[model samples]
Target: MTLRSRLPELDDATMSAEQRRVLDDILSGPRGNLDGPFLAWVHSPQLADHAQRLGAFCRYHTSLPLRLTELAILTTAAWWKSQAEWQIHAPIALKAGLSESVVEALREGRQPTFERSDEVIVHRLASVLYQHRRVDQATYDRAVEAFGEEAVVELVGVLGYYALVAMTLNVFEVRRGDEPLPFDEP
Candidate 1:
């Protein structure tokens, strides 16, 4: 697939003081660079600032563990078929201890064979939430039983935040390098 970003990256000279400040904060944060949706978000600095703060919390400070958080993010990326999101988070998920089989299954649009109960819980929560747009009682109960209420809430936040990331990447046609689309065309 040929993908080109609809939004141009903002250079320092064109950025307002606010935009520059936001960009500076992002550069210094865990993200360490303005890539992906941030390239489009820089066009609206205020929104970028707030969105980045929320994203930072969800990604860095959430109650859910990194493995669970990454799983939820990968689930969202796969559901959206968001190449940029998938490319960004897939390795992170692997490093965070997600199995290659699970990541590969997600990449290939297949149900993954999860070894851990926590992995299964997270995947189920994400899949149910993405597919149904809400968690049913059984899945909600299972998630709470596995992760507790606070972590469950944070899991949902991770899912929702990455959904926005996927949507932004999709809408703006952000491509992660020259990598081909990971999944078959719909």
Candidate 2:
């Protein structure tokens, strides 16, 4: 199904000063362009500002390795069935060394067999949290054991930030174009 965005991008001429400022920040920041939920978020400039900062930290400064970080983000995207998030991150995940089989399994909603112990830990942490809304003690311990407590904290932050992104994309029906959606919509 094709879903139209509930909030269209604001024309620069119509933007309030705050919105323009946030837009400039987004354009100049690490992301370098507006896409996905940012298009919807610009409607609330303060929210766009704060959320973008948190996102930049979660996506860039987290202690987790790039591969593990992308794994966590993809896990969140799959759980949320967010096409926008999936499209943006799946290639990054593969380029960071996550196997194609793993990405395909995630897209297909299957348990992927991970060769790396760290991948297993990251996937388990995300899956348990999504399923139970909390990680089991064993899962938490495995995560902390694989990555330090600080990294574990950052992993959760990545998940939380992406979950917010997923909600925004889903609620606002954001999309790139008429391309097919990655996940089936009921």
Best by TM-score: 2
For all candidates, the clash counts are 0, 0
> Whose lDDT is greatest here?
2
State how far residue 44 of model 1 sits from its true place (Å).
0.9
lDDT of 1 by residue, 36-115 (tens): 67877877889899999999999999888889899999999999998888888998999999999999999988999999
Model 2: ten consecutive residues of lowest lDDT: 1-10
Candidate 1: what lDDT? 0.87
Task: Name the lDDT of candidate 2.
Answer: 0.90
Model 2 residue 155 CA deviation in Å: 0.4
Off by over 4 Å in 1: 1-4
